[model samples]
Target: MLNVNFYEHIDDTLLKFAVIVSKSNGKWVFCKHRERTTYECPGGHRELEEDIITTAKRELYEETGATTYTLEEVCVYSVSDGINESFGMLFYADITEFGQLPESEIERIELFDQLPDKLTYQDIHPILINKINSFLKVKGILNNIELKDNIIPDISDLIDLYNDVGWSNYTKNIDMLKLAYDNSLRIVSLWDVNKLIGIIRVVGDGYSIIYIQDLIILTEYQKQGLGSMLMNYVLNAYKDVYQKVLLTENQTSTVKFYESCGFVSNDKYNCVAFVQFKM
Candidate 1:
């Protein structure tokens, strides 16, 4: 039996290989070895004196001819076959450009909307792919959901979303909700064709700090990872800003969700938050 485990970090010396799960044009990238019909993610054993990141880059380029791409470390993973264990660093890559495939064991490259059934490391690869997807905070390809930036959604749609989520306070005064959205520094909305399903509102000067004023997903879409996708979009947009802030009710689930997105309580930084709501 094979067992797999994931970690946020591990000692560098224990990492013997680098495995990169990559995508090109939003499709999953996999390579077929010259000797094997099964497909695998582009990766290989770490070379002597080479850091794991360099191994990942070299393997990706050699296996897929991916010349231009962005790579991010996902986590450290270990696979054990009951008795022996091996460790590797997992990475996620977004490939934009490719060159001629280098002379290597990889026979060809393929792209698929989902993982292929025949995988080189059947037991190991699926676990690694699932880990990468979870690390990315994406449940799956969000079919038919279009993300619109800075578009103030129609008041009726907004009202429906708020009401569905039990935030009746916002729907009670439609005019004020519209006005608030209009004044937001940035607004990202998720539209299922004509229906508004989720939104994230930001308010800040765009330089020193940005506050997540509101982030909501329609009740039906709450657990599908649409909320995390919206939050990630805004986080990447303001990544250069010094501070990203938000306030929320101190509920267990809500706190865990935000913490998973890399937020910490003010007390952690020896600070406090103050808030005053209209009576």
Candidate 2:
């Protein structure tokens, strides 16, 4: 059985190739080699220390003769065939034209409405297809969630979103809220067009320790995975930090959500958080 492991960031030196899976007009485009009857996604080994992204485009063109297209990154993945782990970046493309078929090792190209029975990498094709579909669905939704980093938002809009999410205790002191944002190590705000819908703020030295100071999504936007999107954005940005921390009210739903994002209770490390209330 082949095992795959995913990470937020890996040493690029360990990367092997860029695998591009393309679709055109709702049909999948696959490559056929002169020596094989089985079809495969258009991909090739990295050459002469080229960037993985460049390798993706070059391989797609060389194998499928694709000229006009739009490509989007899907993810970075590593597959272990029970011995060695091979790392590669996965990409999605929408090919519009073949232009002219180039002379290469590829024999021909084919389009299919459904996956063909003969695939070069049988165990991997289904996994890549599922990932592509999931990526398309999530990208469709997140396309509207615009994220801005290190930006000073309009205070009025900030207050309004804070109030809309019932964080009125903080919004009540607008200056304090503004000051907190100003002092944050990093801030990522999510907007729907001109409307502010979500905000995530971080504090502490960005290298050694980072704390999620605040993460709020307007009540109307809650439960739509926007929160997860914001959290993921933050995690990806600060993935190298040694200590990532957050404190939230101990609600079952809240705990479950954070746990799903790889967060664990401090109790698991024999630690506890304490706060003092002034009377």
Candidate 3:
């Protein structure tokens, strides 16, 4: 029997290969070798003195003719066949353009919405695909849910979302709420079909600092991991900013949630936070 295991990180030396699960214009990219009839994701063994990432890029370009693309490390994976084991780094790529196929073992490339039944490595490909799907879902890129940037939702939908979460201050003044959204540096809203389900609003100079003005999720979706998804989206968008800040109620659950998202308390920095509100 064959077994596969995944890890967030491992010794770089252990990664002897690199496999890229790629997509172009929302279609899966798979390649067929000149010597085989089955298809597989583009990948190959790491070469002498070549980093795993370099191997992935070389293989992708050679096999699929992917000239323009974005690649991200997904995780490390190992395959064991009772007596021997091998390790590889998994990557996800979004290809934008393709040039002429490089002269290589790959005979042709195909795009599909789903994987073909005849795959080159049946024991390994399915497990790797599942890992990629999970990674995309966590990064808020997959699933039926849609995330919109700076899109102000309908007033009724906004009100319903805030009211469901017991946050009446925003719902009480629809005009002010809309103005707040309009003036913010960025607003990321999450939707389930047409229903507005969650939002993360930011106020900042867009360079040195960004404050999380508000993050709200409809009550029904509270424990569904959508909040972290929204938080991760904003955090990644502002990763280059020097400072990321937020203020929240002094509650245990809320503190824990933010902590899990990589936020540190002011007290840890030996600093205090103050806010003034007009009565």
What is every candidate's alpha-carbon RMSD to the true fold?
8.2, 8.7, 9.6
Scored by TM-score, the top model is 2
lDDT of 2 by residue, 1-279 (tens): 898654434557877988898999999999898999999999989998699889999999999989999998776677888898888988899998886778998999999999989999998877888778877875775677788888878999898888887777887788888899889999999888788889999999999999997898887555456777889999999899999998888874577578768899999999988867532
Better of 1 and 3 by TM-score: 3
Per-residue lDDT tens digits for candidate 3, residues 1-279, read: 789876544567878999999999999999999999999999999999999999999999999999999999887788899898788999999999999999999999999999899998999999998888877765663356799998878778888988888888887788998888779999899987787889999999989999998899886555446778789999999999998999899874577578768888989999998989653
Error of 3 at 245 (Å): 30
TM-score (all chains, Cα) for each model: 0.52, 0.61, 0.52
Give the alpha carbon lDDT tens digit for every residue of 30-53 in model 1: 999999989999988999999999
Which residue ranges in model 3 land beyond 4 Å of their true spot? 141-279
Cα lDDT, model 2, residue 120: 94
**Candidate 1 lDDT (Cα, 0 to 1):** 0.87
